[model samples]
Target: MAGRIIQVYGLWVWVAFAFFIFVLFNQSHSPLPHSSGKPSTVKERMMRAEKAWETSVTLRHEMANKHPGYPRIPLFPAQTLEAFGKYPYTIWDFFPPVYTCPHDIQRVGRLGDGGKWVCGMSLYENRPALPASKAGKRTKPGTVIYSFGVNGDSSFEAEMLARVPSAEIFAYDYTVASLGPQIAGPDSSRAYFKQVQLDRMDVLDRTPPFMSLQTLMKNNSHTYIDILKIDIEGAEYYSFDSFMDWCDRENAGEMPIGQIMIELHLTDDENLNFNRLLKWWERLEKFGMRPTWLEVNLLAVTLNPNKADPRCVEYVLVNHKDRKNIMRQES
Candidate 1:
């Protein structure tokens, strides 16, 4: 969920955060293992939450002035543990993918083994190929990064192409004409661009309207994609099942994609409701994908909690096989 944890209150590690929260609030944290401290008094909890709220504000100011490029989204007071047992909707945004994992996600930012199993907007998950010139001829990146919303911002794709010359990228969005540098120039990397819309299901056509993941993969002849990154408005749900089905049919045991970093649009579609989407998410563990990072959509949710549930959330899910090497557990 590279869409996750960056100083989410110095959220680099749970041990550091557990110590920070416990020393400040004294409430048990369900996110980490060592946070089994007895729940604090309601008054004490409120005080702690208020302090956290203030810290978040200051952090925001600091990031805005200093590192404008790496912006961090804030969490709402309602979404925090401020009202833990006293409220119902308090947790509408409480989904920590690393802990509850198969169910929901919690905090955001780079959280993984700090090595291979990590997710979030962390660095170097897809390192550049050696000897850039020869690496470009490989025809594909070691990991395939699919960026959806090309809302005139493509620094992520551009950066990855510079680093990982061997990896190929397919950036989509009907709005943009092309993603970054053109694909044919002598200086062009392996990044490719598409203007098609993504949906749950579709058939190949001359028009190439809303296409499915199945069709996308087949058209590219890609049997497997190392990482699937998506941010296509609220259409994430439409193609998730199809992606899994393709994995089921192709690999028989392991899902083809090793990791998925996507911004989920938690829309209230009747057929693909939130609860139903969660059920499908839980099923992912069976295929070896497990949640590792969570970050709420500040623009859609935190900035306006009173409006409605946010449609955008970012998450990073890694495969089961990477647990030992990639999934880092705190000591």
Candidate 2:
């Protein structure tokens, strides 16, 4: 009886051990959780979330850095605030400050009631002076002020010329928007002064009668240009060099120019970056011109540590001759 009892007890113990082993193996392989007493802390969860977010941001920044192109830098909030202060004025007003650019027979400090000034991508401000005479006299009927890239809009230039209506202004722009052939006439408001000259050539292309600046001046019999405004996109870097050469030839024995206004384009292109900008500074210095107004556009950020955007600031160069004249009229 005692032996039979021992055998049965041994069998029961082995069954119990086998059941425990089965449970342990099943728990290890099962996806569902066997609850543990302790729970995750709030601080731990927060730390994990923050770490994940930081990792993501770092990865994105790394990708951007490795990309083979210019990175876009957004304008700072300060720039927007500055832009607002110059309200009712174009982007050019924020630059070169108010009294920086030279004015010819025009008030420099006073703002017009509803008048628009000549505002360009680069720094230039055009304030109109009262007509040369009270009688609304016509000085030179055929006198023309030639601008290369008029595009479609002439409202700015037209308003400036209204102060000097005696001169017949000839603005040349090839890509001007076409309203219609009839709408192209000159009216009291600023419109194209004459028919659109559609010679599909760059200002440098030598295509005969319209090829060179010399030809244009000779054909028009224009001995002098009262106000020369040049804004030809990024091409101004090249065109201005050529134009200066022409000016040297014409002003050899004559007055160089009564007044000059130009919007110089600066870029990070091979021959037109910030270093080239310094070269421009040198050239303007030689011409007896100094920057009266400067407006920076902040076109792009450069990879080169020593370089920055060429158009970061637009400069308005004025002949030193006009500084006293401008200050006297304004003061």
Candidate number with greatest lDDT: 1
Q: Rate the local accuracy (lDDT) of all candidates.
A: 0.55, 0.44
Candidate 2 clashing pairs, residues 3+ apart or interchain: 96-293, 96-294, 295-314, 296-312, 296-313
Candidate 2, residue 273: lDDT: 39
TM-score of each: 0.58, 0.46
The segments of candidate 1 whose C-alpha lies over 4 angstroms from its true place after superposition are 1-94, 99-136, 139-141, 180-187, 206-208, 272-274, 302-306, 322-331
lDDT of 2 by residue, 87-125 (tens): 223223222222233233232211421112231211123
lDDT of candidate 2 at residue 322, scale 0 to 100: 32
Question: Which regions in candidate 2 have their CA more than 4 angstroms from the true location?
Answer: 1-144, 177-210, 253-255, 297-314, 321-331
Give one digit per residue, the lDDT tens place, for model 1 in 54-78.
4544553453344222222222223
- What is the C-alpha RMSD, rounded to one decimal, of candidate 2? 23.5
Best by TM-score: 1
lDDT value, residue 71 of candidate 2: 43
